[model samples]
Target: MAKDHYSVLGVQRTAKPDEIQRAYRKLARKYHPDVNREPDAADKFKEIGEAYNTLSDPETRARYDRFGSDYRHYASSGAGPGGNGGRWGPRAGARPGRGGYGNVEVDMGGDVDWEDLLGGWFRQQAGGPAQGTDHEAELWLTLEEAVRGGKRTVRLAQPDGATSNYVVDVPPGVLDGQRIRLAGQGGPGREGGPQGDLLLTMRIQPDSRYRLKGRDIYVDLPVTPSEAALGAKIKTQAPAGTVTITVPSSSSSGRRLRLRGQGMPNPRGLPGNLYAEIKIMVPPSLSKEERKLYEKIGSVSDFNPREER
Candidate 1:
């Protein structure tokens, strides 16, 4: 079934722009693929991302409300979400062999002077030679690498037979989808103009064990029913390492435990907190002795959990 974008974000169709953004942020923090691993999480995240990308822009939002599913075709045709042809797919007249998504060539305007645009304005005034075109490339990184800061060596595949690797040092606290730049790494200088920069669009790898929400990290921590009932300090593993966590006595399942400074760091250089959500494990079968003990305890305990409900 096609999902209603408003319903997916838990917002009414009449929701204001800010309201829609807030709803998306709230739900995205919950179901983002990096944080959620349920079978439907990735689909849900993509849906949410698509919805946000469309509704966040005024022109696209207007067209979406007017056209609904049919709007997608229009949106992909370089209408509605203008300049997003790469995200939606190739442009209307893209060549069969042409690539997009940073490879799409745009004709700025007939008035645009190629030689002037390529070189500094001085060269343009003097009618200098056509400048070298800017080269584009992509770089992928892991979530942990983006968070903890690490060094990466990327092998650049140039058109020529020669291949070279560039060592890149990623700073701590980098967010997903953030771009980095390398000066003078683009096409060589043309007509005495300096070479353009190399732009790196980052794509963070998916994590299996951790989910990042803004600056917070959430992990499901399994606990035995007894552990939930009569709390104990048990050792648990964190992304960094193993650490002992104390489950408060009489705690219930789904209780969240906060570990300060255990999450991804922020731009301010302070690490975010980690949240452990408790899930009580109940064995399907019980031993004879266990059953007998439970029966005896039930006979004396008068714990009718359903009485109130």
Candidate 2:
């Protein structure tokens, strides 16, 4: 049997929200497809992600606790009341042809798709032409791709039991949870009605280079001792390309340098800014001359960084 949400997250059923989040972050970092090379890393990551999403939301978590995974929507549609299945069919005098609706019967005795079952009942009660239900799926993009916008291809399982491919035209400045719509790409309409849409929700993959907040980006800008001491112009990675920016003299770690309009671009309006934080680094190994020079400077200078401490 498959693992439950708590099992997947390595948490108890009574785990607190913060505890759940902590466990999720630890597992995500370890199993993330981009980070782990294990054969099952991608699948495990997806499973944990689904587990975290379900457990993090109170309403959904309650629903899951009550009815298991199918409780998502299926169980709710099961035999509305008193276990009498449901009332679903075309209305009387309704046209049945190419120009109008048609008859598509099913044997709901053994097994059936509850999603389709619910849709049919809804359509019959509406007493009018109804479009198919919209489908939702997630699309993961790299940090660079989310900023630049490009063609991303996705393969989905069609209603007819076949997988089809589509090239999504991702827009620039896309962020996590942003929805992109694809018209008439979802479930097929019944009785010649128009098809529904497919919606793709964007999720920028976790990047080690930068952190994102809305439109702005934060990145670590490493500098050598000389560069931080005397100031220097250094080339660094930006959302768009490599750009040179100057660091002020006597800079310290955690100092932020802003690059205006160098962040995610907007298709409609002004772009966001990128903030580079200074991180001074020293060479791990030193040559004889380099060691001598450092010793001399130490003897000549009376700088005490630990005075405050």
Candidate 3:
């Protein structure tokens, strides 16, 4: 039995176009083969797309609603929805020929082209070129590469044990999960039709030194105890290059210093800010002179960090 389109999309039969579209998008995101690894996820995703394609269109929805499961069969048979037939059976006055079903007269009212009917429904033309299918692939980029956009060579494996290389132009400040489209670079069209597009989903590789949150970047800045106690200018790493930053006096761990416009560069708008989180480091082993100096300072100072706030 053909699955019900409404049931496949988990939407009511009376769902509006926007409601159906929303359900399709939600299900598609959950069941997309690229994101979901379950064995049946690909099938479920395809089913959802099919349901959306049918229900989203007013004409297709009307046909499906009238003919139920046999809509395609009835439509391709040159029988209108109001034809003198029950579902997909023959007309009321039709007589069974030899073998009880050999000859059946279908009142098409005029000369009908079966090929044209089926082809039109499937978005194809008889003896004509057809557009190719669009393709999607993931493109992984390092944090540095994402920050500074450039041309990258992408190698895609074909089904026939061959590979094709394409140079992709990545724009700066492209967020993770964003898509870049390459026009007419997908599967070849049939009979010289226009080729489809290739969509590349961006996947930013993780970096140990930094963490990204939207356009903002967070990085741990290791500072000596002396530097923290007394304000000092220090050099640190940024996405583009090393930059000198100022450390405030008496700064503690976890204190963030903001460097405006030092993060991911945005070609469209304002650049992101880079935050340097302070992490004070102490000497592993102190020499005799250092120990004496610390002891002297400890004796002179009456400050107690363990005191109640």
Candidate 4:
């Protein structure tokens, strides 16, 4: 008995064209002989191709819907939906003795070209070896790692309960959501064709010290109350390293000091800038000398912060 084409493709009889195509692609990728070494994989792949070929075409699908598995026989014999001797006949302009059913021409004696029938990737596969499908994965990295590009080892979990490790070369200044393509590292090709690429999307891990917005880097610059009142040179940590920046005199909290080109580096264009946001800090408890000095300053100075506000 012939197998149901819709069942073979794992789709409903009423499945849409795009749905059928998607199912075919997924099953073909899973059971392709080059990818799946199981004994039944090749047979399964061929069955999927045949099902797709029969159902992908609108005319063929209509006939299949009407005639089920025997659609081919009915198509070639000019039989109606009922049986072999049903009342369906050739169309008005169909050539006689051509085995025509409606407008479709049935080829009686030629070898079927599954490649042409299947189309898309199968067409390429029929010509020769077929390139494998590309694969995508997320690769999480620290902000420091993104800033300093280098080789790092990554482990990917496979479908068969195993893991594959790869040493990936990360590019400098790689931003969050950026994809890096590793050539010939994706799904294996069929019949010795070239392998596809493995695309790794960069996911920068959250850091307490640094926050990123586009190419710009923002870091909190903590300053003492004295430093904010009477400008001072402070050493703060940056992605590159520790750097000394002089705070402007009378600098207040929430002030932003921009460091040009000290942010994320851009290989193609201008590098991003780093913004240092000032955050004032004070001692939890003041010493006796500090209290005396504060009392004296309170008596001498007329700086009322509330009045200014």
Which candidate number would show the highest lDDT if scored against the true structure? 3
Candidate 2 per-residue C-alpha lDDT over 1-309 given as tens digits, one digit per residue, 9 for 90 to 100? 657989999999888878987897788667766557898877787787778767765444655665576646533223322324442333322456632224543335434545454656643543445465465567889989999998899875432324578789999899889999999986566456788788888989999998988789888999998799899999998868898889999898999999999988878888889999999998999999989988997999888878985
Candidate 4 structure quality by residue, lDDT tens digits, 48-138: 7678767765555766776678777653323443232344433322444543344554433334443234334422323446576565567
Q: Evaluated with TM-score, which candidate comes out highest?
A: 4
lDDT (Cα atoms) of all candidates against the true structure: 0.65, 0.74, 0.75, 0.74
Could you tell me the lDDT of residue 217 within candidate 3?
91
| Residue 178, model 3: Cα distance from true site in angstroms | 0.8
User: TM-score order of candidates, best first?
Assistant: 4, 3, 2, 1
lDDT per residue for candidate 1 within 176-265, as digits (tens), equals 777778777765554676775666667767788788887787888889878888898878766556767889987878899999988777
Candidate 3 residue 146 C-alpha distance from true site, Å: 0.5
Q: Rate residue 10 of model 3 by lDDT.
A: 91
Report the poorest 10 consecutive residues by lDDT, candidate 2. 74-83
- Identify the superior model by TM-score, candidate 2 or candidate 3: 3
Q: Is candidate 1 or candidate 3 better by TM-score?
A: 3
- Candidate 4 Cα lDDT to native: 0.74
Judge candidate 3 at residue 25 and give its lDDT: 67
In candidate 2, stretches whose alpha carbon ends up further than 4 angstroms from where it belongs are 1-126
Assess candidate 4 and give its TM-score to the true structure: 0.63
